[model samples]
Target: MSVVNNLVDIRALAALVPDGAKLVVAKDESGVAMAATRELVRRGVRNLHLVTVPVSGLQADVLIGAGCVATVESSGITLSEFGTGPCFTRAIKAGSIRMKDATCPAIYAGLQAAQKGLPFMPLRGIIGSDLLKHRDDWRVIDNPFGTDDKIVAIAAIGPDVALFHAPLADRFGNVFIGRQRELMLLAHASRKTLVTVEQVVEGNLLDDDARSGATIPALYIEAIAHAPKGMWPLGYGDAYPIDAAWMRAYVQMARTAEGFESVVAQWLAGDGALKPLVGAGLGELAGAAA
Candidate 1:
């Protein structure tokens, strides 16, 4: 999988995601995730799983209403608090799609087990929690070498697709994530991957700085979209600032399923509803239209 440098279009990137596929989104407030989610819903994808480090701003509300079975890595937040009143929240409480903390070795081992094509991995934690109640997928087996009572075996999560946004990419799809390594592991573990980059540069930007080229090479990349300001709402460090007003409006509009669909439609129609701020590279398009 040496797909480090290549450039492709958004449509090409979106095409890789099939209907009814289970998608895992690396949680970020970035417009890239927002746009990717909108596209997934627009394409009739029903099972969407969102994975984020214990923090908000991934727009859980939108995914839940779209019928996506959302999952979040536990970060000291109680199930009751996390499950609140959102649609996906309720679904989680109702047991439609399971939720657990990957920060724990048990959960991380489970994902690793799946990535390695193993059936399960032995875990010492989660002995008395309700996580064991749903043991249909997990099994408690005795440690052959030890006198311990039992260890929980967690299953792997190999998602159907993964989408992420990077700071720079070449026309051939070589991505440079800069400092935001955000969920780079889960993105690589997925069967297919889509990347939306700020600008498509030529040659190897990684040659100048190896620290910047932390993620997958171009071979693993399915497609690269030249989407400037795609990381809106999530600041790209020195690249740009978060758009607070736009993020607030986006969250409100995507609160309903219908509104979510409409937003995607507007985006596809080139109405510039989700377009980046002026002077951020998209200003030329705005000016040409005017």
Candidate 2:
């Protein structure tokens, strides 16, 4: 199969994201695209209106800490077991960024509405919750078919770009996402979708029946880069393990106001200063195997 023109280097992939763009990324477990995220911070992309599919961790916090984000819309942001996202905490307390509190179902419904080019998607999960009061876009409406049933309609979320990392991508731009189906929704709903993958396989991914069902067609992809271990610090769908200690160190070092900036700078410099030095679990196993 002949490769399309969508294949590019990591820097070029990151360059496709504009400053102040409405950027959408997936959850921590669902391909965070950390390599390109670091590149974004390096390039000083600012005022991003970030939407995490449901929740997030490192990638979102790093962007918020680096001042690359102006607003965040998500159900929640945390470091999993490590604790709260210190940078996100500071931002919220300082009132530096706008917040759009949301539920997972509402976010999905909104994206689905955008995918189908609809004005809004109806949701029953947040009908009587306080979130309806805070979110103007989420409206309460009585069911036209029924007498008194009430459901909230979520406004369409038409993002400028959607980006994520994946395990395998073909030279033809077909991204293999396995069981992560929301990635497809993200691609279909957003204006442009960019991908970074652990490997770019030969020939056509759609040629095989086993691979075709899980692959996102190239029509929905704007570009893809070959980024091995792209989800470092976070795991890659059983391909690797999450570096919990590295994340713990990040949380520890980034406790102070200036500490967040120092952590990012050191990590970007690739000085081995933040390379998960706990000598246990994930990093230890990796070292022993190496």
Candidate 3:
């Protein structure tokens, strides 16, 4: 199928994400859109309701530290091996952003409910958990067809936009998610889906038999940008490993507000800001993510 060439620059992709929008992001392993996220910070986007599919890492910490988010709904937010997400921790302690606690299954169920156009999705794992008590939206309901069986009804979660990074996108706009199925669901449950990729290939991904199974159709994608290393500092599938040195640096610098500001300033000043696209044409058009 033909498409309108959803290819855009990182800045344009960030422009599509506005203030006060409900934005959902993927987990680190699912291809985090760090580069695009930096652009959002550069534009000074504000009041975003950020939802992390299950959980998140540096991206969440960065956005929270930047004051771009007003609320965050996620199972948890941590830097994983790098330790606590200092900015996210600070935000919660200061009550700067509303935090809605959730479980991974509950989050998936909520999105699934939204995908199916349902008001709520019944889940069992969260029924006896503290998250259910903390989340009033999650209700304990009696099983309709069983006796005395109770379940937690998770409210549907649909975002204004779903943003992520991926390995590749063809000139036709199809993205190669390649086993990260949650991205498909994220796209399905969101009003729009934006993608940044490590490279732009010459042909449609869907037309290739081996890659077709893991590709997301262009119809579900609003726009895509060619951004090599878009997921830098974090790994992208099996293509690369997390940049351990950078992770350590971020963890140390993000400990204080002042240090964090310096980090952002340096990043925006081109330490990590996007440079010009390299090469040209379908066979060679690829550039650093940011």
Please give the distance, in angstroms, between residue 16's alpha carbon in candidate 1 and its true position after superposition.
1.1
User: What would the per-residue lDDT of candidate 1 be over residues 1-290, giving only the tens digit for each residue?
Assistant: 34443455666666677655655554453324555555655565555455443333434555555565445444323223223334444456667655654444554565567567787777777777775674465678888887967877777766677677777776545677665664465455678778887777766655656644574566667777787767654566677766555554445445444444444444445424453333333434345433
C-alpha lDDT score of every prediction, in listed order: 0.57, 0.87, 0.86
lDDT of 3: 0.86
Q: Write the per-residue lDDT of candidate 3 for residues 115-219, one digit (tens) a residue.
A: 999999998866556776678779999989899898788889989999999888998878998888899899889989999999888877888999998898888
Measured with C-alpha atoms, the lDDT of residue 260 in candidate 3 is 73
How many steric clashes between backbone atoms does each model show? 17, 0, 1
RMSD of each: 7.2, 5.1, 7.3
- The parts of candidate 2 lying over 4 Å away from their true place are 271-290
State TM-scores per candidate. Answer: 0.69, 0.93, 0.91
Off by over 4 Å in 3: 272-290
Q: lDDT tens digits, residues 156-262, model 2?
A: 99999999998899878899998888999999999999999999888899998998999999999999999888888788877888877677878986776556655
lDDT score for candidate 2 against the true structure: 0.87
TM-score of 3: 0.91
Best by TM-score: 2
In model 1, where do residues sit more than 4 Å from their true spots? Answer: 1-6, 29-32, 49-60, 68-107, 249-290
Worst 10 residues of 3 by lDDT: 281-290
In angstroms, give how far residue 91 of model 2 lies from its true place.
Answer: 0.1
How are the candidates ranked when ordered by TM-score, highest leading? Answer: 2, 3, 1
